[model samples]
Target chain A: MTPLLDIAELAKRFEVGNKRLLYAVDEVTFAIGRGETVGLVGESGCGKSTLVRLINRLLDPTSGSIRLAGTELADMRARAFAGNANRARIQMVFQDAGDSLNPRYTAADAIADPIRRLKKMSGASLKSRVEALADMTGLPRELLSRFPHQLSGGQKARVGIARAIAVEPELLILDEPTAALDVSVQVVILKLLQQLKRELGMSYLFVSHDLNVVRLLCDRVLVMYLGKIVESGPAAELFADPRHPYTRALISAIPQADPDKRVGRLRLSGEPRSPIDPDPTVCRFYGRCPRGEPRCSAEMPVLRTVASARQAACHFA
Target chain B: MTAVPALAVEDLSVEFRTRSGTVKVLDHVGFSVDKGETVALVGESGSGKSVTAFAVMGILDPAGRVTSGRALFGGADLLALSEHDLAEQRGRELSMIFQNPRTALNPIRKVGQQIADVLVRHGGATRPDAPRAAVEMLKRVRIPDPERRVEAYPFELSGGMCQRIMIAIALACRPALLIADEPTTGLDVTTQAVIMDLIGELAHESGMATIFITHDLALAAEYCDRIVVMHAGHIVEAAPARELFAHPRHPYSAKLLAATPGETVSLAELASIPGGLPDLRRPDLPACRYSDRCERRLDDCARPLPHRVIGERHTVSCWNPL
Candidate 1:
């Protein structure tokens, strides 16, 4: 079966001064199966956001193909993509629900805006649909009339999720949806997302820095570093036995709630190498890798299959 | 255990006046940090974690006023101290690392100069020799190529780098007590580990008392020796880190732990604590702030909460506990 979303050789570059090129998203490739929740994990400046923007068509990619359900989307200009019929098929729930929502817009209005724009429904139908969406997302009906500021963090998050799914998008892109919320609220939101995916049969591209959350929610995981995907595999297998050094560092860095579970951590020493005009021949994790050797700096390792349904970009995996 | 604590806060009550009304931010809060010990003030936002830290630092907003309490540090009352005395003790004997390092740092000043300013002001270093000491501090924080990076501005560095610079400034004077408020909230997990390791090592070496305020219980469990769980301006539970995780006596603490994602728990098993924090400004608030959302609440919850001693070092303020 064809995947819900297939991305190949996706790259986005920014032109810094002095004829320098910042490779924000460099030759990334991944796919999401229908109803599958794929997690994208990486640190800051790892091009995770840039890759999300490219797939969402909010920003034009420098090169590569983004095929949604076998339909080419990269060829369409980002500006024109807004009016395209496929616009409603892909939706994004932003990181900060409070900031993403318009302050003046009431919760009801926020959820209705997307449905009205995309579905072209109005009057009683739109009102009932908004109410239904609220009910589906477990948002209290009375709170729908309240503005963003009047609602709590978890309420605002519910509104954001309701708005994104109002159009019944085939794929939902969640960019750190629970980063700003408390753990108690985060669990509710994560459960809601999972339920929504099951009910609607929608695919999810869950991008988050919280490895614990990713491990719980994602079916497959992609570990990106400095714009390149260093590892990709089944979530359980990858986290249990990460092949790439970067993935290993990220997993071990997660602070375990159980103090007894604490072990000696694998610390990444130096900062990430400069992204601007980086040498293509050198590995991105070379300087910071705990197991770095001369072979790592001399040759860039291409991501290759190492085990059953596991891939790692390293000289020795 | 008998030695005078590095910092002892007794019944610290703070109130903030807002357009709505007077908000009781901290209600008779009390905790103690021993010398060379780390205690985490763990809670969700608006749980008075930062407010407690701000009150101790004497940097509470002008609108906020300390209604009652005594913060004893080295046999001196920090609350009763004058502004001048507080200022003198702030950078010299007490220091804080703010949440956002980019804003905490001087934007226009070079990173090295900022570190130097702290050293010269509190470390008694001459202006001419302060720069050299600042570079050494940067190197100690593990900033590679400290000589070149010292001249760089805050904006020129990454979030982690700026945070290291902030740590350098905070530890330059080797203050007896340090308050780090969500120092690694926005940082990556890898950077968070490194930064936390750096702070832990430095504090261990200096025998400094650390008050770490963060909402992440997991992080608190990993780094802190004790965990103080706060809710609606009240400390519901305080216990040793392992004991708190292994057996949370308070309902709120148990709920919080259940909510936190872990290696073994699946998404379906994670139980979110229902309801939001009660409004602090309400005049008819319940004696137990968590009673409204608590499943084990009883009629007795309407009365004053009792501080139940479970273990030698564990305490819970609750009418009905787990």
Candidate 2:
């Protein structure tokens, strides 16, 4: 079966000053099937943002191919891609709806702007479509006249979701959609997203640092270290039996409410290596990883599979 | 076999004078953190968790005021102290680590100077020794290449590094009590664990008490020795970590446990606490703030609530507790 999105040998690098070249993302590859939800989990500066930007064509990849619905996107020009109808069918919802939504724009206008830009929506038809999207997302009709600042965090999140689905997109990239919300409200938003995905048959590229939320939402998970994909597999399988040492450390760090069931505490020692001018010979997780070996410093390990759809980059694995 | 509490708060009622009217944010709220103990003040947003911290720290905004309360810290009423006395107490006897490390640390100042400032003010270090002590603190918090990082600005460091710098500054004086208000909210789960471990270890070493304020019940359960669950400006439950999870007496506490996602169960079993916190400004507020949303609310819930002891080191404030 053809995948909805596929990435191969993706790498992105940026030059900082005259002396250093920052490797923002390095040799990452993954695919998302239709209606599948894949979570990209990592700490800050792990290149998850760079990978998403590369896939979305917001930033040009240094070298790689991003096939969205079978079309290679790396070769396209910015304006050409923006004008492409397929671009409208793939949308993104960013972190913090309050920050992303324009304070001056009302809920209706915020949702309508994307539709008007992409679908050429206008007049009464545009108004009706905006209301329909709001209704679908369970947003109150009374909130249409309120600005972003006037709405609550959950309501603002709904406005953001309503806007993303206004075009009936086949793919949605949600970047920590529930990170800023309260836990109770977070549950409601997650349920809404899950329902929408089922109803619309859309694939999701979910990005977050919260492992529990990722576990709850994604079918598969990708673990990233300093600008590299350290591990990837089915969420349940990888979490239950993490092949990579770094993945195991991450899983163990999650604090469970039940104090009786204490997981062994593993604090990752030392800081992560700098992204700029990284040593090509050294592994990304070498210095901080608890299980690092002497050979880890000499050769960079490649992603090797331990089971079906499960890959981890480690000498021990 | 418990020593006297380092800080004991009683009938601590705080209100904010709003343009609309006087909003009773905290009503007769009280808790205590014994010496060398870790107490987690857990609650949702707008549940007066951070407000209580700010009130204790004497950092409440101008719009807010403590109407009535007694906060006895080190045998002196913190509420009765003048602004000057409270200023002297800060950074020496009491200190706090805020939520966002990026914003908490001074952007223009070098990380070393920030830590040194605390050392000079509270640790009584000479100017010459301040820099070295600052680097030592940095190393203590497990930041790599402490000497180099000391000279670097906050922006130059990663989020986790910035957080460590914040922790270094907070622990520089080794205060008797430390208030960490959502210290790891913005950090990754891995980094959060590391930071919490560092704080816990240092606090234990110094025999210092800590009041950890967070919305994540799972995190609090892991790090805290005793858990104090707050709801709508009131402490709903206080229990030992193991006992609270095993047999949660408060309805809110039970709901919170069920809401937290775990490795053992599917998402379908997770249940969220329904409804928002009651507006404090409303005139028609219930005597029990959680009564409106609680599933097991009784007729007596409308009356003034009192703490009911269930077991050793366990107390809950609910008329119809689970």
Predicted complexes: DockQ each: 0.86, 0.68
The residue pairs found clashing in candidate 2 are none
True contacts kept of 2: 0.68
The lDDT for every candidate, in the order shown, is 0.94, 0.89
Model 2: CAPRI class: medium
Best by the DockQ measure: 1
Query: What's the TM-score of chain B for every model shown?
Result: 0.99, 0.98
Best by TM-score: 1
Off by over 4 Å in 2: none
Off-target runs (Cα >4 Å) in candidate 1 are B1-3
Native contacts recovered, each model: 0.93, 0.68
